[model samples]
Target: MPEAVIRTAPSPTALLASLDPLLRQWLPRRRWFAGKGRPITGLTPVAVTELPSPAPDSDGAPGALTGLYHLLVRVHQPPAPGSPERPGDCYQLVIGVREVPPTRPAPGLIGHVTRGPLAGHVVYDALDDPRPAGVLLEAVRCGARVGPLRFDRDPGHEIRTGLVPRRMTAEQSNSSVVYGDRLVLKVLRRIGPGTHPDLELPLALARAGCARVPAPVGWMTAELSGDSWLLGVLQPYVQGAVDGWELALRELSKGEDFAAEARALGRATAEVHTALARALPTVTLGHRAMARIADGMSGRLAEAVRTVPALLPYAPGLRSAFTALGDLAGQGRTWTAQRVHGDLHLGQCLRSPDGEWSLIDFEGEPDRPPEERRMPQPAVRDVAGMLRSFDYAARSADTPVPGWAETCRAAYCSGYARVAGHDPRTDPVLLRAFETDKAVYEVVYESRHRPDWLPVPLAAVRRLAAPGPARLMP
Candidate 1:
């Protein structure tokens, strides 16, 4: 963590301006900070909405704040050494002001104010304070509008406010506060414009009567300066549930079969896809789209080979996969495309005590542009991502299980075929190409971030890019 940049200001606007340089100095240092290791050109304030300070608690306790502010700040970064420049991303910030310094350091403290209305006061992240966090829930429950922000509650579900909140730690991109075990509210740290798939897909599935997802009970949004931003969302948190990644590792530790669980998860995935197809727009992928996708994959592969010299040996084999995709497009074949969990992996799923698999985190790939995430794509992309995860888990374990990942892979495809009316295995050409492309991506990612884990994906690269055709199962 970086040291907080303290500043003194006479008023709110001045406080923001004084704190701007400090925020820019601190942002790239935090783990949840997305633009880490990059130089932040500037921080642009898009909107700032003030919230009513809460009154005393029922037990007559003082509220955390006499003032609350919700901010939308756009973070700008310059282009990579050789890449083109891109647009900045918006982030949500909630700050609280108090007359006295906190007994303990606040979660997101940026230091104290030294002058004016907030003189002799301390300022910290409002969501880190229980009282102001409650205000967010209150607004959601009553469907109220505070300044430019609007909160909405699903009429079918009731709200439970005033629960103590504890911010979850060690997160990568967002901050989530678990409100007493009743609801887990995820405050999106990197605020993007328009509706996120995390909100849109679940609501659509819930309305289409799909039980494979935990629907939001309440949601919060913002319409400021002619742009809309998704702020926070509330969902019923299933207690005693373990995420699929942890569960898979646990079973692997015991040398137990995970094929059955994998099958069920595959069915759940197909069900969600079916529901999404029914609820949202579906398009027939055109030749131009296929060409573009093929070209993109080829470009990524070229870039990966340049970065990881180990990929040089497999370049020929990798080129064939993209070439095959182009061949498919040239044949005038027609394919259907629809919304998919753009970043599906074992960590993105939850397994309940009752043995049901619920897919969570519909927010697509955070690295990609939001506009691209909303576009329709082949559902096989998700299947490919999951396959890579299954392999990664087995390889990452202390005791690597032979034949285990392959068995689960086949069983999962079998289950998917049962519901989707078409086996992903049947489309060998597309499936192989997608799997190869995904493995190449993993190799690049692991090489850059976790050098020790590079061998895990490199193993797949060697196999998929071998002389024989890419094969997932018997």
Candidate 2:
């Protein structure tokens, strides 16, 4: 275990005041705040954990607090159907507040506080809290045995670890605080128990020497006896890089040739699939897995179609696509199921300064079960994901032109086929099936999560539905 950093003296009153207006205003505006857009009658602070100040000034004031000040806040709200009545409904907010001089030099702190629970909070960028950041890094470098983490709902599994924290830009499910640019510690807002795929699979892959992904460093778990909640994971952060999506978009926007880049990305992705197949145990692609995949897509697609009625007409076509793909199971096309990066879109890949592509985030889709994510399936699933991403890059352009998708797709498929040893010409049916399946999934995803972005996937679906050569490039 790493050496424990002594916690700073409690300054609850000052800290509370510092959090006053900001806490009140920020909650309602946040997407994960449970009570988003709803009126919070009151906020009661249930717990506070203080840590030693990172750097203390002459008068004993903390230059910054290094440890995390985890506050369990109870937010009062009206009861909704199926909503929990007890304090269980309250959200746990782990805020890393650092006491910096009113005038500190940091690039991220330039913006003033906006609205919500943090409306009036004199909050600066928490990354300014080097004390906490350092403590987190040390924990990652040298494993630490900290207190057992308990989930409010179930208290059977006891999770204890000293993992470092690194600050990251906002993501879909949680706010990530990275550690040493090596690992990302994601604190989940919408909590649940049962091993999280993000933590489980990435660790498995890294241990297996899958070069495409960031290695897992540590994890924070919440025990509930029979099941455990994966509160956070620490994985190496790929520095000096841009996600593949942004890179592709830039290439398209500037009218630059992306064939070479796309081909390289394809090769990397194929290598990942090959590694995954070799490392993990095989499973027959039977009706159960196929049904699960199909059912999952159906549920999400149905919900999305409801949210955007404009997508109603496409839902039937999308369902048919999934159904056709699902029927391919048990045809001797099964491959070993090892842990895979559930979501493999261009946005999930990063291009290092050296121009090498590195995959990040092992947590399959945010909504799927860990077992499902860990299950082995066709390697082409990942191929489809990247292909869809290529389409997205073209569609997301300010002024998309013809032929870009074809150019990139051809290059990517060519590269992947070379490494995976799959000839598109011979496997035309299988390749087209994968692409169609991905397009269907994207249509529903974009419609619900990003309405304005629906056209990207919708356009892809329309193209696939229209029928052309299976392989875009010769």
Q: Best lDDT goes to which candidate? A: 1
User: lDDT value for candidate 1?
Assistant: 0.79
Where does the lowest 10-residue lDDT sum fall in candidate 2? 150-159
lDDT of each: 0.79, 0.60
lDDT of 2 by residue, 391-428 (tens): 77887788886788778878888898888887443555
Misplaced by over 4 Å in model 1 are 1-13, 55-66, 98-106, 112-122, 303-316, 443-455, 469-474
Task: Give the lDDT of residue 357 in candidate 2.
Answer: 88
List where candidate 2 sits over 4 angstroms from the true fold.
Answer: 1-52, 57-68, 71-92, 97-128, 149-166, 170-172, 176-191, 222-228, 237-239, 287-292, 326-338, 423-449, 464-474
Clashing pairs in 1: none
RMSD for each model, in Å, please? Answer: 5.0, 6.9
